[model samples]
Target: MSGSSRVLIAEDDVRLAGMLEGLLRSEGFDVEVARDGQRALHLGLTAGFDAIVLDRGLPAVEGLDVLRRLRDSGITTPILVLSALGTAPDRVDGLNAGAEDYVAKPFDIDELVARVRALTRRASAVVPTVRFPGGRLDPESRTVTLDDDTTTALSERESALLELLARRPGQVFSRALLLEEVFAAADDPGVVDTYVHHLRRKFGRSLIETVRGVGYRMGSLS
Candidate 1:
């Protein structure tokens, strides 16, 4: 990684965790260790990281549960699962639970680090900084910066909604479309309106324009 990429290590094995942390740190990654699944889940939800190394047999909360919850909350951080369960079904279970990659326990440290580096590179390349009328949004950091240079952090859903509209400025998107794209399919379309209201309140009323009897589009921001 060219820049310092933050990584979270969620492994309960003391010796193994120490080794991973030491190696990752030596490789220039800023690493944080979480000894239990609860701590891992909390950090994953609240903090920002380029990638995460998660252990499936975590204590307090299983690693798979943590992964699912992170995805449910709209966290797009790349995750790699480390598990002793090396069966085909086990790998599928990890991937299905939202892990980007699965590594069987007793893995090669060099290979694991390489996989993490690849994940961070892929993530950085896919999400670029989005500039709109009055501000620019950094999707990677989930923050928006106004022309005045004031920056505000956004929740995962808020950032996703804003980025979607900002990317296709002035393109009308209906509530149903926004709901399906930004939220759970089971979520009511009204949730779109709710989030739009949130964006306007945080930014300004002119941040988004509502189309009468239709939907919403990017506003002039003036």
Candidate 2:
């Protein structure tokens, strides 16, 4: 779930855009490049990017304008704005316009990667109040509380998958469905299996019953 997902980068600077794309790819991210704000808005609206690396100064439409439009359209993908206009007002403006974070130009690649990672951690996350027979899964904080008041913390992906299963305690969910709803990695269905394995290890195998030829579900603990 970390660094193995898609990211869209919107930068008008050809060299900077290429650099950002290459950097993200080197870190194992699926990269999409948009050279201007209009294209950025189009891609941001239609495509499902885990996170966006946006530049404040873009052709056609400014990055902040794109963010405003996306927000208006109810697109909540985390945006990290990268710009050369490094000023208190500029950073404030970018953040105020709906960017989750701002990075001034000529920034350290590692720092940029760190910011991107943090933003993705939040975007791909699910926070739902999901209930099963004897337990409740809280996605916001990634915690599972049992009927006995015992609580166990889960990772982001684990919590998301658990929340999906908890929604229908006895109903089975196939790997494909889980991939679509929980894993957020539609390219690989096998990722669901890994998270399911993690869930089994965390909450005990009996809690999640896997149908031999089918899929898995949250079973009654009572």
Q: How far is candidate 1 from the true structure (C-alpha RMSD, Å)?
A: 13.9
User: Candidate 1: lDDT of 56?
Assistant: 90
lDDT (CA) for every model shown? 0.86, 0.81
Which candidate has the highest TM-score of all?
1
What global local distance difference test value does model 2 have? 0.81
What does candidate 2's lDDT look like per residue over 1-222, in tens digits? Answer: 454877999998899889989998988888999998898888877566789999988999988999998775546678998999989999999989988899998899999998898888886674435666677777678898988999999988888777666644445778877787876756888888887788888777777888888888776666
TM-score of candidate 2 versus the correct structure, residues matched by position: 0.58
What candidate 1 gets wrong by more than 4 Å, as runs, is 128-198, 201-222
**Candidate 1, 108: how far from true, in Å?**
1.0
Give lDDT tens digits, candidate 1, residues 22-85.
9999999989999999999888865668899999999999999999987765567889999899
TM-score of each: 0.61, 0.58
At residue 131, what lDDT does model 2 achieve? 61
The 10-residue segment of model 1 with minimum total lDDT is 163-172
Candidate 2 deviant stretches above 4 angstroms: 1-3, 127-222
Q: Against the correct fold, how does model 1 do in TM-score?
A: 0.61
